[model samples]
Target: MKTALLLSGGMDSIALAWWKRPELAFTVDYGQLAATAEISASAAICSALDIPHTVLRFDAKALGSGDMAGTAPDPNAPASDWWPYRNQLLVTLVAMKAVATGVQRLWLGTVASDGIHKDGTPEFFENINRLLSHQEGGIVVEAPAIGLRTADLIRQSDIPRSMLAWAHSCHKADVPCCHCRGCNKHFETLQELDADVATGD
Candidate 1:
C-alpha cells in the first residue's frame, strides 16, 4: 500500500519514519507551542530521508490547552496535555490530504506509552480505520508502534543518531526545555536505549 506518515518530530515518530521509510510525510502545524521546532526538525529529517514532506498550516491555538499551549492544564481536565479530540482532528486532516495524493494508509507514531490517552488506544485506531474504510478513499490508519515501548521501537528501527538528533519533544520551547513531560520521556527513552540525546542548537 502507498503509505505516508504523520511526522511529529518526536522520537517515536522519527523512529517510525526511519523504519518504514514512507513515500511521504506530513507535519502539521496545528498552533502548538512547539510548532516551529517541530516543523524545523521534521523538515530536516525528511530531507535526510529523501522523503517528500508537506506542512499543513492551521491555526488551532484556540483548541489547545495545558503545557502545549503555554497555559496550565485545567484541574478538571481529563489529561494534562489534552486538546479536545486532537488525534481525531489530526487524523481527519491528514486523511483529507492523503486522499488527494493517493495514499492508501497513514501512519501515526502512537506508542505503548501513549495508551494513557483515550484517542491513542487500539480501539480508537480500529474504529477510526473502520470509519476511513467507509470513506471514498479507503485510507487506513495504522499505529505500528502502539504495542512497543519507546525504547523498543527505537532499538527496532535503528535510526541513525544523526537523524534522530533532530527530533524535538518539548511542548513549551523551540528547543527542548528538558522539563516538560515530552522532553523528560524523550530523555528517559534515550537513556533506556543507551543513545545520546541531541543538544539542539
Candidate 2:
C-alpha cells in the first residue's frame, strides 16, 4: 500500500522517515513558530532520501495557544508547548491531501514522550483511525514509534547522524529558542543517544 508520513522535521519523524522510507512525506506549515525551519529540514531530508515531499499551509495561529504560536499557554494546557487539538487538525489536513494522492497509510511522528498530551495517546490514534477508515478513502493512521522514546526510535531506525542532523525541534522559533520544551527534549534525546553509544548499548 502507498504510504506517506507527517514529517515534522523533528528527531522522531526524521528517524521514522529514514526507517520507513515512505513513498511520500508531508510537512504542514500550520503557523507554528518553527514552521520555516521545519519545512526546510523536511525538504532537505526528502531531497536526500529521494522521497516526494509536499507542504500544506494553513494559518491557524489565531486558534493556537502556547509556545508554538508564540502566545500564552491555554488554561487547560498540559504543557507549555501544548496546542489544543493540534494533532487532530494536522491529521485531518494531511488525510485530506493523502486521500487525494491515493495514499493508503499515514504515519505520524508521535513518540512515547508525547503521551503527556491526550492526542498523542493510543486511544486517540485508534479513534482517529476508525474515523478515517469509516470515510471514503479508508486511510489508516498509525504511529509506528508511539511505543518508543525518541532515542530508542532513532536507534531502532538506524538513521545515520548525517540525515538525523536535519531535524529542527524548536517549538518557539526557527532559530531554536533553547529554553523551550521542544529544544530541551531534542537536546536530551541526543544526550541519551550519546550515552548509549558511550556505554556500548
TM-score of each: 0.94, 0.98
Q: On residues 136-169, what C-alpha lDDT tens digit does candidate 2 reach at each position?
A: 9999999999999899899999988888888999
Clashes of 2: 0
Cα lDDT of all candidates, in order? 0.89, 0.94
The pairs that clash in candidate 2 are none
Q: Which stretches of candidate 2 lie over 4 Å from their true place?
A: none
Give me the displacement of residue 81 in model 1, in angstroms: 1.4
> Once superposed on the true structure, which residue ranges of model 1 sit more than 4 Å away at CA?
195-201
- For residue 8, model 2's alpha carbon misses the true position, in angstroms, by 0.6
- Model 1 residue 2 lDDT score: 97
